[model samples]
Target chain A: MIGNAGDMNVVVCVKQIPDPANPGSLDANNNLDRSSKLIIDDSDMYGVEMALQLVHAAGSGEVSLVSMAPNGETAGLRTALAMGAEKAVLVSDDTLKGSDALGTAKVLAAAIKRIEGADLILAATESSDGYTGTTPVQVAEILGLPSVTFAKHIEVDGSTVKVQRQTEAGYDEVTCPLPALVTVTAGVVEPRYPSFKGIMAAKGKPLDQVTVADLGIDAAQVGGDGAGQKITNVTAAEARKAGEVVVDEGDAFQKIVAFLDQLKVI
Target chain B: MAKVWVLAESAGGKVSSLSLELLTKARELGDTVEAVAWGADTASIAGDLGAHGASTVHDLGDLGTSLPGVSVAAAIAAAIEAGTGPDILLVGQSYDGRDVAGRLSAKLDKPVLTNVVGLAAGEPPVASHAIFGGATIVEATFTGSAPFIYAVRPKSFAAEPSGGSATVAPLSVPETGATNAATVVDRHVEERSGPQLDEAAVVVSGGRGLGEAANYAMIEELAKLLKGAPGASRAIVDAGWVPYAYQVGQTGKTVKPTLYIAAGISGATQHMVGMKGSKNIIAINKDQEAPILQIADLGIVGDVHKVLPQLIEALKARS
Candidate 1:
């Protein structure tokens, strides 16, 4: 099957998120602050590597990176360029500054439409903040295209993609016609490191920017007001109590052995 | 109000565990939960869905044992359109559920919510997904309007009996674009005991502390007696202690069981995301300092070989 492979063009959607550990804070309205708490999520970074593999394989069509972060997400775009995306486009704007999954996809779809047509659009299954995991399907829906969620492996030929869709059990290899959207999971491929030379070259790549205004979108559609549901609150989970001691070690092993003896497995 | 739809998965006239779990959650979310079934005569499964709360069961005439998920999605969409559109479409988070939900959500312009453990509706339908392995919980609401389709996490919500008659009807498969896209040549299912992990309410997971792959027997033995599923840390899976399918972490499968037992494993944030949403967590590790102990509801500071045997014996006695 590899011998009969054809060239493929792939585009990936990347989002910058706050590190999950330090989810940081939200406002009175339960809104995540973009400027203060923004960095790229690790999963989206993997999405980049998946795209690179498709484009790098047999030198098919171009691999492009599209980010839907607030204005000044060019650093992420540059990062993608350094990692070897052929081009980068940032869909940024104040209106989209507070976009949720739907608004973000709306902006991204417009940005993707502006770019030269793509054979596939790649994305992570979910984002850390919203964690809703709805953007890919929403984008595919709005664009009137087919989509596969949580695709573990993708082999492409021009516009058609044979995707290994992962389920709770095993996986299924489903082929969908060209111009489909695929949201990937981890372990698809190890992301590449940006070399010094590649980093330098990335600085010179074109990074066209688009905002909600640029897309002729309703400003209300791009902000906190646009999110169909608002986050009511964010609080730390209740702390767990420490563990029980069945036995210590060495000498504790004997005590544990005694404990097990009581339970009667011995 | 448009009746909510639950797409019941079946093969050879029988429903999978995930379908039952989905029906359980669907009844919890909507007032009128109806099921859309396909593949052979699923009248029995339809009855089962009613026993677990289904107002209507729209059977699409058993398309086949392994119908393309996209084709099933088309049939579901057509049913939604012809009858009252489902207020929200609920599905299992399995492969077919994921495939059908992804295609249906896009085609229907509804939100796709995956790996959910719970469901509630206020304005937009909200679902809970165990993220960051299990350290954090995300309560996310669908992005848009009603009829939002979701592939809910199995075992996340408890199934209940809403016993009553369900309206069973026929739905024709729609020839959406994917009809000519790809065809399934054949399908082979991976065999494993210990209930489907995602569908298991009790999951006993092991880690490097087991010392050897054969040591997994202790964990498996306990899981079997309890009728629970067994999960492995990435390190154990990488060490070849267990198959990759059993690994539960950022790098492994995600499970939101009711009770999760972690034996002899240090918890990485990656590993925690997979099982954090478990209602109760118990960790037994030789290292009392293991990070897993931090999230454990009941932690036993000891080697798994010692603690596990005792625990297993206690369980066996009780049974």
Candidate 2:
């Protein structure tokens, strides 16, 4: 369901990732424990902010959100709704748990197709927790749409959207037509804090919930059973030993250089 | 003998160091190693790629100065369709590299393993990724068909020249109509006086302990005196004290310098994942028990505001 005959209709992908500040525990399957309190990934805020700005700039458009979480947890989705998204589409099902990047992308692409008249899809380059960094492009590929990644700046003109894509050495100015997907980098824009009025208004926002059966997605195509890549084993990294410490007693710089000399790094 | 292909990135006719690193690693995993490049003449870098164990170099010719994501990936997909695809395709973790890998995965309906740090020799190959901020290493393997694509992190592997030359070849690819639709209008490179944060041998980073945005100048000055690059923790960057280009963290750029000096940073897991691979780590903060100190090779228990000025002066005097 799309709303408002605005200049553009944008669907922003938001993730409710585990809080990075808190150490996460592993489940019986050795997967991240999703039972903990989840929060909006820091990187996803830029995409939401960018979509809001684009819709506002267009003078008459609506921004909807799409998220896939375990057991239909909407705590993270509600945060995005508070940021002024008109509605949300949450795809949560037991069969979708542990779906790899590709399977997740497939589900998101299906939801976007169901939206009827979406012109653009925006997502963060990667989730703070998963950090697979390929889902947005995978979604684009499944939808047969052109995709741009690591966009630092975006401008919409007529039927085309221009982006300043970040590069190793610099940035490249790339323009693609509407019906494209873009994944934005963090700090691309200053995200606005949800106001009291906006937060209160979010309670009434429409959040459409769907299941794998509703989307007609095969259970075998998602979750651990269908993942193309399997984490065969995981091991703890060797702990770094407590090294030498020096009180900065006026001659501390010399000690630092001496240590650097030992390592031949300076 | 598995066939391996690396997406070589180039600028001004020189191949990227990360591509060379991939080629070096590819040599050990496959019997045949090839490289594919776009937008620039491949002849200039063919010899360079060969030295890294590439047996053949494929050139896509010039596709204009636009972003190479669409054109390069389309060319590779066409090659795959023509029965010239490799068993494994490796690309750097850079922006354009990921764009190409993503589009190629889409075109081929293959899943791409990204942020790979290590690889093990196998029939299909296994990739290792550092997760939860480098606290754990998880190994994954592809279960599907050929052409297992991976976007590898920079500095994960060492690039060594084998001193061998390769045969250069021109690959003809069918025109993909969507390649040219996305055109480049302008380009801007941030003007920095010193080494890039990712490539710098020494990176001196500042965090919120710098107190105010203006105090960042001291970090820059110290980095300059040490002949290194200036970096920022997520706190400072998020506070608008520095541009995102200088941010060193999981959400930012992953850097593996010879020496990484963290000043006043609390050593959050996100930031640690980016620099934990550095050859050496040194932390300078007043809090002796900060998380960063746990990983630092040398922890200086002192105030950065007081210690940084003196260190800068000492470095200047020595230089």
The DockQ leader among the candidates is 2
Per-residue lDDT tens digits of candidate 1, residues B1-319? 4457787887655676667777776655667788888766767677777787787787777554243466777887786677566878888766566567756765664546566666776545677655444444557675556777667765556566667667677767776663335533335456897587766877889988899888999989978876788888866764556666888865456677767888888886667767776776777887866778778766668777766776676667767
lDDT at A225, model 1:
70
- Candidate 2 docks with a DockQ of 0.62
Q: Mind sharing the TM-score for model 1?
A: 0.80
True contacts kept of 1: 0.28
Candidate 2: Cα lDDT at A129: 80
Question: Across residues B119-221, which tens digit of lDDT does each residue of candidate 2 receive?
Answer: 8889788899887778888888888888889889887899999888888888765676653466777777878899988889899999999999999999899
- Chain B: TM-scores of all predictions: 0.77, 0.93
Q: Candidate 2: fnat, from 0 to 1?
A: 0.67
DockQ of each: 0.26, 0.62
Q: Which candidate is the best by TM-score?
A: 2
